[model samples]
Target: MKLISWNVNGLRACVNKGFNEYFAEEDADIFCLQETKLQEGQISLDHGEKYRQYWNYAVKKGYSGTAVFTKKEPLSVSIGIEGVEETEGRVITLEYEGFYLVNAYSPNARRDLSRLAYRLEWEDRFRAHLKRLDKQKPVVICGDLNVAHQEIDLKNPKSNNGNSGFTLEERGKMTELLASGFIDSFRHLHPDTKDVYSWWSYMPKVRERNVGWRIDYFLVSERLAPAIADARIECAVMGSDHCPVVLELNGF
Candidate 1:
């Protein structure tokens, strides 16, 4: 099975920048999106009739949101994380016959780190939520997780250290998640690959120079590692500050 995850930044704006063309060209089995930044009835997407769409819109209009478009219909679909009142519409879980697919847009700590405390708390709950799903079946979690994870994950880590996404707290949570039973698919497959990134700053020459972070990911249960056929960063694709990440699995 092939899956793609991208942080569109804003779906409407991205569409104008040729999102549809890229979507059709990739033709992934499942395409997950983050930071949709729209509510219902805001915009309609013509992705053909073959794909089924699922959206989670935030209570706040034009804010944080997520969506999934899949060629295969899931057995069940759910919104939000367990035991949490999710007002931001950051998570969507689709239950398939073989595994659970979770699309999440994790909260950013903000430029001033004002939301760091809340972000940390959210990480704890999110981890718990994933663990619960893993107990039932292997899980495929993907999206813009909003963390750089390690030094190799971002360009100029020394300069970015303690920044919102690269802080020790944020990276530690990611480490904890992987330790619990998940595998970061891209890093697992290309452990030494450098100068590859998914999200970039809008600053002049940032993206051009490849000064960015691998904040987006496709993490699978450790047992599913053997099924991983490919995991890649689609850095060339454009529409938003972030590009798409692709994952391919075999015998799913």
Candidate 2:
């Protein structure tokens, strides 16, 4: 099975930039999106009839949201995690016969770190949610997690240290998640690959110079690591500040 995850930044704006063309060419079995920034009836997407669309929209207008277009029908679909009232529509869980696929857009800590506390709390709850799903079956979690996780995850690590996404607190939470029986697919496959990134800053020539962070990911239960066929960062495909990250598995 093939799964692709991307943070479109804004779905409507991305469509104008050729999102549909890339989507068709990829032909992914499951395509997950983050930061859609729209509500129901705001825009229309004709992803063909084979894919089943699921969306989670935020209460705020043109704010954080997520969507999933899957070729396979999920046995059940749910939004948000248990015990957490997610007003921003950040998470969507689709239960398939073999696994639970979770698409999440983690809350950013903001440039001034104003939301650091809330972001940490959200991480704790999100980790707990994933653990709960893992207890039932292997889980495949993907999207823009909003953290660099380690010094190696971002370019110019010394300069980015303590920044919102690279802070010790945020990075520790990611470490804790991986320790809790999950494997970051990309890192698992290419432990020492460098200069590769998924999200880039909009600063002049930043992306051209490849100054970016590997913030988006496809993480799966540790047991599923053996089934991972390929994991990659599609940096060339552009519509947003972030690009798509892909994961292919041997068995459904």
Candidate 3:
């Protein structure tokens, strides 16, 4: 099975940039999106009748949100983490016969670090949620995690060491998550690959120069690691500041 995850930055704006065309071409078993930045009834996507659409929209208009398009219907679908009052529509989960697929748009710690504490708290809750799912079945977690996990994940790590996404605290939280029985699919596949990234700054020349961060990911339960056929970044595709990350799994 093939799955693709991308943080479109804004789904409406991305659609104008050929999202539909790309979506049709990929024809993945499941396609997930983050940071949709739209409320209900803002836009419509025609993915053909083969796909089932599931959306979790934020209460605030034109803000954070997520969606999933899958060829196969799941056994059950869930919105947000249990016990958490998530108003930003940051997460959605689909329970298939074989696994639990989680689509998450993690909260970004603002540049000033004012939201860092809240972001950390959210991470803890998110990790706990994943752990609970893992106990039931293997989990496929994907989206813009909003952190560049390690020094190898972003360009100029030295200069951006203390920045919001690259900070020690954020990186540590990612480490803790991975240690809790999850594998970062791309990094697990290409251990030493560098300069490849999923997200780039919109500043002038940033994307052109390939100065970016691999904040988006597809993480699976440790036991599913053997089924990982391929994990890659589609850096050449363009529409949003972020590109798509693809994962191929064998034996379902």
Candidate 4:
């Protein structure tokens, strides 16, 4: 099975920027998107008839949202974690016969980190939510996680110290998640790979210099590590500042 995750920045803007063409070329069994930044009735996709689409729009239009386009029908679909009232559309869980596929748009701390406390709370709830799902079946999780997990994840770790996405607190949560039997598919495959990033800053020359962060990812239950065929970052794609990340599995 093949899965792809990307943060499109804005679904409407991306549609005109070869989103349809790139999406068609990838031909993933399941595709998840984050940072859609739209609301209900904002945008639509016509990707032939084979793919079934599921969207969770935010209460605030042109804010945060997520979507899942899968060729295989899910047995069930959930919008957010239990006890969490997610008006921002941060979580989407699709239950398939083989595994549960979850796409998450993790909350960002912002430049001043004014929302850092809220972000931390969200992380706790999210971790608990994933653990609950694990009790039922293995999970294939992906999307724009919004954190640079280590020094290797970003270009200039020293300069980014304590920055919103590169803070110790944020990265620690990721460590805890992996410590609890979750595998970062790309990093697991290339433990020491450097300068391989998924999201680039939209400033003048960040992308050109390859100064970016691998904030997007595909993670799975530890038991499925052997099934992981390949993990890649499609850096050449250009629509959003972020690019697509892919994970290939041997069995469905």
List ranges where model 3 is wrong by over 4 Å: none
Model 1 residue 173 lDDT score: 96
Q: List the residue pairs that clash in candidate 2.
A: none
lDDT of 2 by residue, 18-80 (tens): 999999999999999999999999898887698999999998999999999999999999999
lDDT of 4 by residue, 170-207 (tens): 99999999988799999889999999999998889989
Q: lDDT for every model?
A: 0.95, 0.95, 0.95, 0.93
TM-score of model 3 relative to the true fold?
0.99
Model 2 CA lDDT for position 243: 95
Q: lDDT score, residue 232, model 4?
A: 95
Judge candidate 3 at residue 103 and give its lDDT.
99
Q: How many steric overlaps are in each model, in order? A: 0, 0, 0, 0
Q: Any residue pairs clashing in model 4, and if so which? A: none
**Ranking, lDDT, top scorer first:** 2, 3, 1, 4
Q: Output the lDDT of residue 203, model 3.
A: 93
Error of 3 at 172 (Å): 0.5
Worst lDDT 10-window in candidate 4: 39-48
Cα error, candidate 3, residue 50 (Å)? 0.6
Provide the global lDDT of candidate 2 against the true structure: 0.95
Query: What digit string (tens of lDDT, one per residue) describes model 3 on residues 70-152?
Result: 99999999999976797999999999999999999999899999999999999999999999999999999999999999889
